[model samples]
Target: MFRRDAGLMAAYLVDAETGELLDDLTDHRREFDLELAHTNIAGDLMDLDASVGLPGQLDPIDLADSLLVRYENLWAELTRSDVFDPEDQYLIEKRIGRLNELGFDVEEMEITTVDNGKQVKMVPRVVEHWHHKRRLASLTGLQVQENQARRLLNSLNRYRIILSEQEGRDVPLPVAAYRWISEVFNPSVQIIPHDLKGGLDDAELFHEILEHRWYLSEERHQDVGMPYAAQSYVDNVLRQRHH
Candidate 1:
């Protein structure tokens, strides 16, 4: 069980049975050997190498403390909010932009007017880093990066339009997503030759095809269908990667 200690700001590997830090793994050597010891906070375990021959040269407790301090400082900045001058309304936008730059998306925020509207207090209601990733996984069961999920959602929307037009009725989002995944995303990816995959995963291939479609549309001054763009990308770009 991994639990965060706010005061320590570091996740400790605890001995579940003793309810204490698993400081010495030597006792558990028979169960779990430490061949490649990995610790969080930018792999600070490399600092231990200098103490190979010395018993107390590298203190794990001190290392954990340092990591905790760094974590606390970073967590504070990302979540901190403050009162701003009412006249500078753009301050909120600037803060939101900074949050986005730090890989967080503000879903909602609470704003309060104080000092008779002379100041504004704004706090994020929901702060999340995996906004698009969560949405894509929930709707389509496809785990992907935020940008890739957003682009794929746009493609799914276009597919919905085609479905609605063909059926002459309103098509639900889930139904459209299912059809898009089955008829378009799945087949398009599965058809890619194994050797020419070029280390590209399914989500990456989907994203690249979407980009290829945009370029083809730009050149022709109209939309090039997904099928055409995908085939061209696989045959020309992916196949020629080794060359």
Candidate 2:
């Protein structure tokens, strides 16, 4: 009825036993499907899945263990043994760097005089860089982890710079990004044979290609282009890995 009324953009049929969507319905999902999948309710699913104790599923205890480790690590890094002087110039940068190293980005920081106005206390408002994941998805139609998005964006920025240098003018980011997607990224991905994809998604595959390119360039002491690097990656890395 919804399809007849043109109200349905897509539909899915899932196998209840396996929790897998029907293969035939894979193409029916809209562009925003992945974005929707990563919403707040995804956390609830993760928690439920963890508790279910299903084989090959994420373990709740393990998840808690990892979170505890990360919490302790952050606490250790942010905690100071002695009071810092209010005028310390490098403290902010140092704190920001530590947070960034832990896969966080500081959006705002509040530093106020404390300890009888002799020392300062610093509090940072941070994000886990989830915006990078969203930005990459919106721009490129690719959903990837935050670190992978950061890596891809770094590569895109480098591509933009080279393009600007060649054209002798600053190219806007969105424009350069489209060009990079068409010319560099898509082409490199196309070179990977379907059978040899090794179950990796597009973003992960592209990241591996970039890593392979860097490794080959360093080894050969020259800039090996994307095509060459991609072919080499397929032959050496992808072929060698078991699916």
What's each prediction's clash count?
A: 0, 0
Q: Which ten residues in a row have the lowest lDDT in candidate 1?
A: 30-39
In the range 1-243, model 2's lDDT, one tens digit per residue, is 112212322222334554555544342352244334444345655668867754677655565456546755666665443244433322333444465565445432333335642232333334432566887777787778876776676566556645664676767778988998999889999988989886888889998987788777667655677788889898899888844
Cα lDDT tens digits, model 1, 1-243, are 333332222233346654335655453551232222324422454445444532656565566557556655656656676565443333444455455454444543444445643232223333233456787788799988766775576566556645664676758878988999998899778777888877878998988877777677667755667778889888877878756
TM-score of each: 0.47, 0.48
- Per-model RMSD to reference: 15.2, 17.3
Candidates' C-alpha lDDT: 0.61, 0.62
Candidate 2, residue 198: CA error in Å? 1.7
